[model samples]
Target chain A: MFSPLIDELINALRILPGVGPKSAQRMALHLLERDKPGAAKLASSLQQAIEHVGRCKLCRTLTEQDICATCTNPQRDSRLLCVVETPADVLAIEQAGNYSGRYFVLLGHLSPIDGIGPEDIGIDVLLERLQNEHIEELILATNPTIEGEATAHYLAEQAKRLEVRVSRIAHGVPLGGELEYIDGGTLAHAFNSRQGL
Target chain B: MFSPLIDELINALRILPGVGPKSAQRMALHLLERDKPGAAKLASSLQQAIEHVGRCKLCRTLTEQDICATCTNPQRDSRLLCVVETPADVLAIEQAGNYSGRYFVLLGHLSPIDGIGPEDIGIDVLLERLQNEHIEELILATNPTIEGEATAHYLAEQAKRLEVRVSRIAHGVPLGGELEYIDGGTLAHAFNSRQGL
Candidate 1:
């Protein structure tokens, strides 16, 4: 409402997820009013990231180099590859500190209704990696959503043909989750997957 | 977590209001994965805004020029001044499609406990405008918070000396609000401010 520059900035800020017009305007004003230096730093950083960051050729995870840190790290278990829908999932798995395997980021899941299929998400690239690499086990760590399940099952079928062992991450009530609050689908999954404890 | 450029971008993005580590990472990854061109555009827009947008010389609101459009517009009621806490408040008032008056942005309210006082919020500049301009009415549109009340009271006293009429925006139940769900203070205000219906 103030000026064209501010309007442009506000519109540009809407690219960030979950930011509505009001929030974008607030952000624009906040940057102009209180944090100009920080805004300038953010701008330069965004430019640098946009110019340098790209998908790692091997795993499709975001990186500035040819291969990502996880893919290049010799210490990680190269024989056990975890496949996830997005880089955020990779970060979550890393934060859990349980998995030491490398990752293959699908960047998105297969959604036929949305016209997103195997080839759309670089499944052929993942299959090529499976055939060439020494990976013994492929862990499907995609989300529990419908699209994620379909993608995982399709990848498992593809991996089977290449003689690679495939496994899906367990789906159940989360840790510290109350049984009463858990949804029906999750409760059912937890019940069906119950093992000797 | 992925690369130096990505890490830097994520850290820089945390400066935005409500953005945390996880949100920053998600934004970084989403930009790298989906909208590189949009990211670049946002960067340039941010840089341009940072370089151009500054506080209006008259009202302290954000603007690309020395004076904001509202302050410069001749059709708006210059004799009626609306004093608000921030530029966001100005935008909110404008979006409501009411109040055809000029604005004076205080940037913040008088929070004595936080070591913020009248001078810190440009009270002197407001007094100068009151004295120099032919303003007939001063609308105190600050927030309903304690600090905002104190600021409004202080400005009212200052405006009284200059013989400018002062009025505060009513604090009452919001439009379409149910009394059952309204807070005690708001309900009390609503009851006290009840007008002829």
Candidate 2:
């Protein structure tokens, strides 16, 4: 049958979520049969990332050096800070190309059931950074999940004592969507956060 | 937010078939956070397989040594040889656990349009092997595609002159499938290969 090497390659590809044995096998075969350059690129990238990427000393986001480009950029607004649950979330916001503020990555959200607390997720570090960084505004850009909401609310309360303006991203029926198809949570949020048209 | 290493890892994972940017980001983060053991296992397996498994000198299947265990085993019916397109196909048949005969892996199917001919897919090597070996029955287990059919026909013609019994795998509606939904090619195959109940 296929070489053990092929199987290993297939299994390695299966590290992606939702990729089962069959999908892994297909991917491995495809890499071998067609995309040699792509496969080599992927392998080299994996090795390099594993060897080089580390947490930013200032913001806790993933970075190649002690400080991320966002933190080091003098042109960015140091007075405006956006907080998110993970490093990936920061990238998602950055990709939108609208946000011109600095960011703080939490590494995780508050999950009391899982024993994850604010302190555990670097809240103390964030607080220290907030006080010292001369920030005027704090945007809690965490996801709309229950844990994300709790974390954001907790951060807002903390920011109030520090005399920094805090705000949450509004939740509503999505753009270009039917109200009837929207979920109960979003519907409730839409009703609560309603504005006169 | 995420480290450059994490970004690179996500990009690497995205190169796989069916993986998008979001999925790759999720997967890279997952491996870093929860599936460390799985990732390490996968990496170790990759290194091991790459270092260990090689092509079987006889059948072209993956093997730890020069000849595959299947090819060298004395208990197998060497006279009744099954031909498949790849080592993966051999494993599939083996998993089915019905075929006791030995196998010859072609490494690839013939595709004349892609400049892959009979010899390029190892048909000449197969012929030489057949001439030297003690094979009686040659079962063609190539896939059910147009290229697979053409290769089977060519092999059958070649084996016909050699006076060896040749058979192609039956093509029809799959087991547990309904006849009403069966395609024309399968219906025709079923009609031709029909057996009395």
Candidate 3:
């Protein structure tokens, strides 16, 4: 074992996702041995981000300001709001370069067993936006899982009362995916949601 | 894409070993979103390590004090000195729980092409220890690679002049490693170094 500080650094590094004890040790030693300047930069960056970054008031996406860039951008379509599970999903949709709409990040799905519910994921704020804002279409871009489906259905029902059109993202064999390799659930969903040419 | 601060944080996270851009983004967001306290801890730990940790004066291993605990411990055998390429290797040998001798960290192996000479890896200090410290034996625990072998051979030649016994760690099929899965080079080395048991 190394000194106390080295061990502490290793333990602290394990807080990051997917890093194990061995990896933490390697990282600690690497920074100490070779990249002290990089380590210092990373430390300052983390401190600055933690001190400044907060959830956007509009869409609940993470940002340094009260409202995220995506929510405040004039070029983005205000009349269309896409709902997603996390901020990372918003990045994915943005990177796809097809959506011009604003986003409403749920942060997580409705899992009753885990005690995650409508209010927990800021569904009230979403409903308030639906009633107040002139959002014409609400796109459900949550993952194609049972919990995602349930959350989407619940949000759709809520949006319906507010007269906002709701649509779920299509589920099928992924682009370039062979049908033979596709799972039964996705294949069945694709068949059920098939549209005529 | 996220804000400038978020982007900076993500880029900074990439300095850690094995973290690519995607993983860096994930780590950045993960720390910002779910574990700000953990992030703070990591940042502070990194800062503390960089500020306080320095090489051991005797063994050249990283430690806060002038001498590392291993080098300072009186229980360890002073007459036997194990020379290794890096401090991490010292930790590895210590974890094996067999070594009770002092250590001399080379920090890196000898490489003429890269312009790394004997002095670069503290060969002069090692020779001084062999001469003045009454070291009876020198264990060359450097890696089994070409560079490691070159370094060991160089150190062995030096120690021979000082009248200190020199030995390299065994190179063969590792414990629990099947012969079929072992590489040809290692297998060949194992055959060449076969013991008379």
Candidate 4:
């Protein structure tokens, strides 16, 4: 019922995750009503990021530069490498704040049905980086899913051949989660990594 | 915890309606993951709309032209004018698919407390348009809220003094709404306009 321009705007807004027709209409109305500058800013930023950002050549993380800021930062420990399945995973690990190391971003997890393999998702590039950077340890920080596990295992074997120590992140109960409600996999992990209190 | 760029992206995403911190982060990650072009589309549309859209001088409705399409349409019954509180209200009435009249957008409802008055929301312009366009019937299609009611009443009185016929839309139980749960005011209206079975 709206003009074609408004319809195009609504369609553009619906591209966001979880935004449906009604939500898109509401957002478009709001942009038209209260926030012209904010809307303009968002559009400009989206265009700029989409046009400019690409995978960091070294780590495959999303970045404006060929080498991401993380890769170029001298203060970050280059010897400890955290391997993750996606750029988002890198951000999540970074948010948790315990690791002071660098990252290796795989575009996707190992999904056999999808024809994704180690070589397809920059694992070769990671190995090359590890060899060139003299990385002392590699941490498998991919999710605890089956594909993540397989990817980690494959990377661990590869790292071993290169004489680099390989380890996986511990997964048990999340922070503040009750032990009584913990799942079987988590309980098993906690048990396997048992240490003296 | 992530890069300043990611933080900026997340903060920008939060400007969308119902997008909290978690949802903002999720959207930011989603853009970083699978839908860079989609995100770019949203941003580009936002900027384009912001740059392109301006209020119609005649109706105060959002439009790319000095006059909105609704106001400019020669075939629409110029003598039958509908008054609404905002441009969105105009769209809502248009979507109902029954109104074939031109519109006057108030830009906002009457709010004396916020110092919003007749002149503040282009009441004079509406009057001038009504006279200039030779409108005979004015439909008070503002919302049902207290402010909306006040504005409608005020405009209705003005239209009466101007010798233009004024009519308020009938309100009763909405379609698919339970009549038993309808408020007294609406029930009274329904009774007053009761049709013969």
Q: List TM-score per model, in order.
A: 0.92, 0.92, 0.99, 0.86
Each candidate's DockQ score against the native complex? Answer: 0.77, 0.44, 0.91, 0.50
Which candidate leads in TM-score? 3
Interface RMSD of each: 1.0, 3.3, 0.6, 2.0
Q: Per-residue CA lDDT of candidate 3, range A13-109, in tens?
A: 9999999999999999999999999999999999899999999999999999998888888999999999999999999998999999999999999
RMSD in angstroms, all models? Answer: 2.2, 2.3, 0.8, 3.1
Clashes of 2: 6
TM-score of only chain B in every candidate structure: 0.96, 0.93, 0.98, 0.92
Error of 3 at B98 (Å): 0.5
Which parts of model 1 are misplaced by more than 4 Å? A112-117, B193-197
| Tens-digit lDDT track of model 2 for B17-132 | 88898888888777765565666665555555555666788888876688888888899988988999987798899989989999888877888789998888889988987788
Estimate how well candidate 1 is docked, as a DockQ score.
0.77
Q: Show the lowest summed lDDT stretch of 10 residues, model 3 chain A.
A: A64-73
The better candidate by TM-score, 1 or 4, is 1
Taken over the whole model, the C-alpha lDDT of each candidate is 0.91, 0.81, 0.94, 0.83
In CAPRI terms, model 2 is classed as acceptable
lDDT of each residue in B25-122, candidate 3, tens digit only: 99998998899999999999999999999999999999998899988899999999999998889989989999899999999999999999999999
Q: For candidate 2, what is the recovered fraction of reference interface contacts?
A: 0.42
Clashing pairs in model 3?
A: none
Worst lDDT run of 10 residues, candidate 4 chain A, spans: A40-49
Question: What TM-score between 0 and 1 does chain B of candidate 1 receive?
Answer: 0.96
Error of 2 at A168 (Å): 0.3
After the best TM-score superposition of candidate 3, give how far the Cα of residue A142 lies from its true spot, in angstroms: 1.2
